[model samples]
Target: MSVSDTIVRWRYRAVPDHLLGEILTKNWIDNAIPLLFLAAVVVAFGSVIPDFYSASNVAILLRQWGEFSLLVLGLTIVMVAGGIDLSVGSTFALGNIVALALLNVAGWPLPAVIVATLAAGAAVGLVNGLLVGYLRLRAFLTTLVTLIIVRAVVDMLLLKYSVKIAGAFVDSDAWYFLGEGSILGIPFSVVVAIVVAVTLHLVLSRTRLGWHVLAVGGSRRSAHNVGIPVRRVICATYVVSGTLAALAGLLFASRLGGAGADTGLGLEIAALTAAVVGGNSLGGGRGSAAKAIIGSVTVLLMVNSLVRLGVPSGANSLLLGLVLLAAVAIDVRWLKNRHKVLSKVYVSPTYAALPAAPPTDGDSPYAVNDRLRSVELIGLGDIDGPEDVILDADDNLYAGNRTGDIVRFLAPDYTEHEVYAHVGGRPLGMAIARDGSLLCCIGGMGLYRVAQDRSIEKLTDETNRSWFSVVDDSRLKLADDLDITADGRIFFSEATVRYEMHEWPVDCLESRGNGRIICFDPAAGTTRTVLRNLVFPNGICMAHDGQSFMFAETWACRVSRYYYDGPKKGTVEPVIPDLPGYPDNINRASDGTYWLAIVGMRTPSLDLALGMPGFRKRMARRIAPDEWLYANINTGCIVRFDESGRIIETLWDLGGENHPMITSMREHKGYLYIGGITNNRIGRLKLNDADPSWTGPKSYWGRT
Candidate 1:
């Protein structure tokens, strides 16, 4: 067999992309892997050493894990916040020493001793926080220094005082009960560890503080720009880490009945190893307290099993090192390849045969014209991917660009342009509200409004997620286009639910029904889904009568109409069933007709490939993005249609030299404002026969 054939055969046997995505994205998967590994360890050890599952041994295991779990919990938080606390072991040792000294030597009250020990640990964390957060020191280096200093101080104290908790204190029932006592068959220490883990888990997953921690860790610069108080978040993580480590030290001292210089030796490595193995990323922003507990248990189990199997204590270090290295490598690889893996699952559509060529005769109804060829170029090389353009009542032109800016050009000459507002997502379609606020559909961010003073307010960003979705679909994935109704309701289209805005082409390959139509009422301050499960819904525009709206589903190559009032209220039907190319934005023409922008011409090869689902899936996995057969978006045309969806006139940029991938067009006065996704300049086509003062905003809201 050929190499290509062999590769295909191999891929067929591999895990499918959709299944892999489902498995990887599941929350239970993280804990499940460790749990399975732990089970395997238990079974293997139990077979060789019969007493492995004995009640006494299990109790011993829980006791050991309890103290170790405290350190792991703190480290997990630090790691999740995109920082580390290497001084945890030292802090742990210090807590034990301080507690013992205060309790035995100074004869202090138990509560006071516990308080002082925790305070001492917090002091160390405070120093680390100041250096790393306020001073902007590297977490690794700063924590390493703190670890050394703390460890040195611990050693000096041990040498100078030779301090140890008295045996009499250990004999006290009150003190001994804390470490060895049992409540309803669960050890007190184990109970404490369980409470701490559960509490931290809730905090990390549910609380605002947890969200900020994750946000800061996910992208520190992004967090700072969004006003998350990056320094404070980082600082707080260190303090929590230090305090938890001290608590763990106190537990260790109480259990062992004394404090020693080597009490927490090598404990830092164990804590870090557990956290990493628990599926927490060392790079930050993704870990949990449950993961830490599981990791700690796994490590403890491995060590215990090794001891029972006649393995030397020295081999434990080597085994831990290997495991840590493997876990880190696997996690990094999974994260890096997640997108590529997801892309592979998209099964391309296939046709029974090649699609027929579209006729483009000059004599035909869909003719080629030079209406845009000699147009004036505005914002050339300054605007990036201005998908749609609109004009306000005062004749100011507004266009949403790929760089997340809504640019405005002062009219008459249209020479001066400025950024009206920055929405931080690729802004696709735009419209002017009756009050003159600019409403825009920002891809991946949802709908937003920019007021007269350039201040942006988010109108809506959520929708009712489908039950079939594996990820949270409530957040708008791609808010493609929108239009306002006469009754002050805003109608919009979400391009796709499965993929993000950047992966638009990928969703096209899948041809899945992942798009939806939504409506927002400004009066009620509520947003709701108007329609669901559309095929890449792109552009939206209100009907001339204001009782209905028209939307274009780009992948399906069709335009549909939905009526909320009149005879066809709450009904949907196709306006144009099949098109010559992929449709983008549809806007009102000066003469009451509508103009639609065809972004790209349909091709036979893409249609044929889309028909064969198996072949398309295999191709997606084997080929690179540039090599994949895609919808022909390199050349485009603008076609005018009446209320009945019959084509009247067509304007083409055949060579795509002047205007390629035309996405939007608006008729204003005697000129047509054209926007292209791939063009640097906005095209202006002059219409000699059209009215001179009829702008787009006036045409919609009309001199009110």
Candidate 2:
């Protein structure tokens, strides 16, 4: 390799620029900004404030953060359900007074006091839920009214029993421990808070109810349309919020040993600020418990730092309000444009230089001809997009239809057809096994089989995961074609793991080696990747030797051979180094040769652009996908080649009438059947001087 070319290859292909795009596409990316903000706050405050990192100060901060996070967690759930609970502050105050009264005045045991406090908070929440969710009232106004009424009730009760509660005292050691306790050198409240945080995080992220909550938050109408019981989900969110807030209030009462009229004043504002600032979208459907915790710590530090700086309480509130405004603004704008930002960076193209095309003009074997013009049609308008066609012992013609079914054309006249089996994914390639079962490769799914009884069974859906791939590649993304060895080992091609079947054109633009070959052993019931980093590997055909196979790397415009169990085992060598067009499927011919389907022809412009990946990258980012340059797939042909990879002859539909793009061709009984991925019918052309009784099944299993 030349020095400049090597540098370019290393710069684009060696460095992992695609990892940034993969990371950006993940859900956890929402936590990035909040985490950065938390880090900045800690560093800024810890440096400016005297003794900020002292053990005593750190302990106090943790105590406040532990209780405050509960309220933030509650509000996050309500916000995620597309609602808000302004009454949380009032509910907290009521829980505090109820806990104090039950413990000090009523002399109730700790468990009873805790339960009563929780029940009192739940009662208020139930009222809010009914008013907003069931009655269909505006959430903001209803919660605002509840906040006022609940706060008034707490004040009246506090006034009535303030003297008695202050004079009375609980003598239990457990009560004292609940208020001010340590467990294994950690504050008891911090441990409890961590446990609650982890439990709720799992519930919110991994459970069905959590998904329902997010669905309702994202769009209530859509959720209702999908039969999600929208009103109940919204109502349940409020109950969850109220219950968590009450828990926080109980912890606060234990720590402080008392309650007052101002016990939970403006608590709702602080919690909401923390939730939004921590990256929970105020617009709903986008938040997590970890984000809430990060926000709580940041707010707690900011508030405590201001207090230590002797800032007035009124100014502190004002600053907090401004911070909330800024946070809401950031949340709204960031969520709106995240996809746009991702679109710009996600398609990281790499350098790819395809070899110059071979000559296909007059006298050349690959020269275009009109041999396929007057071909016979099978299942003309009855089928759609038969990407591959095959034949069984009885000469029943089988082809994969675009509607995810294997369509069988009765052989006698090729007129009648029936749905042989429903695979649910686009079936691309087929091979007849020795036992009469039909093995097929399903796009977006994995290898499967249609048994003799017409029952469908999955062979394998996953393989060993790559250790360094940023995206999970264990699950087959696009299984394009398959060929089984004599030992029942099926080798298949996954065309591209980075894009689905529909987005395959985009893969051509990058021309990256995102495809691989996987082998499945029915004996051991295991699947493993046999070859890696091929550019759009499409077809898998066992060679006549039965020890090796040839695969078409479509985007690379080449065919290669891999030996599975011979002296050349575990090695790959080029078979057809360069072809005039893009290759798709390869099948054995009757004369011990192979037939390759050229799905598309290459152009000089596309070939030139492959060497200049920057142009392709800019074109992808600046233009509509339809306007991007693509291979000339609308007109293709079939080529016959020998075992030595020499093109002997070619067949073409000159006027593009019978089959415009040939993806697969099977030779059976002196005729070649052609199929296309975008055509409505299968084509059959006569092949003179070929074995008259030859059949694909007989060629492999020897006339069973």
Candidate 3:
């Protein structure tokens, strides 16, 4: 080992002891997952329908996204700061009604018009905020009362004071400029909304206001203990929320050529849906503006596209209901289940042509919580063809890429440096051997060993498949996962023998039972199948006692255990089952827990496919021997499970720039490491609340 690396490891130990959960929640892998998922939705639709991206369509989409994002932004701030405003839609309606009443009856100028509108909105926000913050009322109950009263009052005022508001403020050039005009080729409203997005981003990310908001949301008692002036921040968020709602109202009125009783009608549903879909945590302390916008765009796109696609008028409400239901599900569920399975994505321009397999370590348990959240994604940009990840004795990481070599990085930072070893083929998983050498698993090319001096030697090109009863198939079907046992046996799984990794789900749908769990004792150097008749086994991890290990069965969405000793020996038991996403790998977390990685999610499309066995059988029969169909696994993400198989937390990528797909996760020391087979580089993140202090891949096991 290099003297510099040794010194750095010593320094990490010298630092203060950090909390495991604190580190786990740090989102160490990549942050841009949500946006990418939204983008993928956009791209998928745009590609499928020509009118989806036309100029007129784009304009409408931007306008709709901007307006809904404004409302969602308002709500997310309150939500992340630990509060909810059920009266947002009513407040929004009242903003327009009040402004229209003033402009029509009193002939108020543009300035007064806006002030009056905001003032009215703020008044409602004040009542709601005071009742909840100072009077200690339940937020939902208080806001519900306010929502009823405000909606009624707004309706009454709109009816009682109806005048031609166009001349005064609604139809004036000034109002039009603010509502629909452009600045630098970008719509003025879009620019305004984006500016608000950037400002909120800064406030939530860098300022004391952001910290206090988080404190207030995380715990009211802790916020009080920290002297955070929780009530003030709470009130401020609502007031800001009201102001923005009024701004949206004003724009809504102008864009529609004046307001009416229906102004901002049903906005609460759309706005709240956007906030939740954007990945905001209703429990607070973890929402981002980026997510709000992405969620808003996604909502608007689906709604608008369905309308444009000539969906039956009767079905429109039903479809909208589904998306809304999904958004609400994403938000409310994440509130209680942030630590559960997370789904996300990766997108990069350079990776446009790469074919990706869901990141799997051939037996690692992968979780599949497809529910969206309100957190910002972190992305790992350009790098080489990266594949696998490994951790040293001290929990530092070493990984591999398509360049036929293994590399090293410091966890937390995950900054890449000099190549550690040069193998002769495409390395996927790197494991530390008992002899102090590194074992490398190469896709399509068998296994090999790299000495301390970086010299490489072949380990085994063939694993026995005699049990399969297939003739003339003498090559190791596929070497996908890796683990070291106390007895020096290498335990791994062949993802599929019937098809290569890319066409795995076909085997999944076929339920072919072709996967096998194999082991190779270094002393004898012969690989043998310990368990056959499995379907797409992915990750491999030994139990702490060293007598048994667990592996992921991807096709069936379960984890199976193989005992190397004891009376239960040679028998397999279901460790975890019915995962929401495709199971990728299972790793031993240093915290005495097991972290499972779920590669893709249970999309409705796949659900349909699963329900129809004949359709799959027929498709397989028609396809050419070498042909493959890409499913939506690219839109899913990763997660972690405990030793008892109880879901603990989720780490997701929404499926784009941050990470298109996360197939593997290895936790080591204080950070987490990530890998995707088709990705050009691996990713690293610090888990703010993760428990494992050390002894992991930094737990980035799949490096691929």
Q: Whole-model Cα lDDT per candidate?
A: 0.82, 0.89, 0.68
Error of 2 at 454 (Å): 2.8
Candidate 3 matches the true fold with a TM-score of 0.45
lDDT of candidate 1 over 483-582, digit per residue (tens): 9999889999998877877788878776756789999998999888888868889889898898998889887888889997899898998888778788
Candidate 3 residue-wise lDDT, 1-704, digit = tens: 35744554354335321223223345421125456667877887788788776798788767656666778888888898889888888887777777667766677788889888888878777786788787878988888888899988987776667555545444468867766787887877688789999999999889999989888988999999878898888888888888888777776765665767666666777777667767776778778887788778877776677777788855866766776677666556654555543211000001011112333333433333333333222224434545556667644567676666677665444554667776656676567776567887777777778887778888777766564252333466567888888667888777766555455555665554567777888788688778776767878888776678888877566776788888878877777666766677677776667767666665555455544444554555556534523344665465566656666666665544566666676776555667776666566666676664565433334221
Where does candidate 2 clash, by residue pair? 179-254
Best by lDDT: 2
- Superior candidate under lDDT, 2 versus 3: 2
Best by TM-score: 2
For all candidates, the clash counts are 6, 1, 83
Question: In model 2, where do residues sit more than 4 Å from their true spots?
Answer: 1-7
Q: How does model 2 fare in lDDT?
A: 0.89
Mark the 10 consecutive residues where model 1 has the least summed lDDT. Answer: 346-355
The list of candidate 3 runs beyond 4 A from truth reads: 1-33, 47-50, 166-171, 312-317, 327-704
Model 2 Cα displacement at 507 (Å)? Answer: 1.1
lDDT of 2 by residue, 169-205 (tens): 7787887666567898787778877887898789888
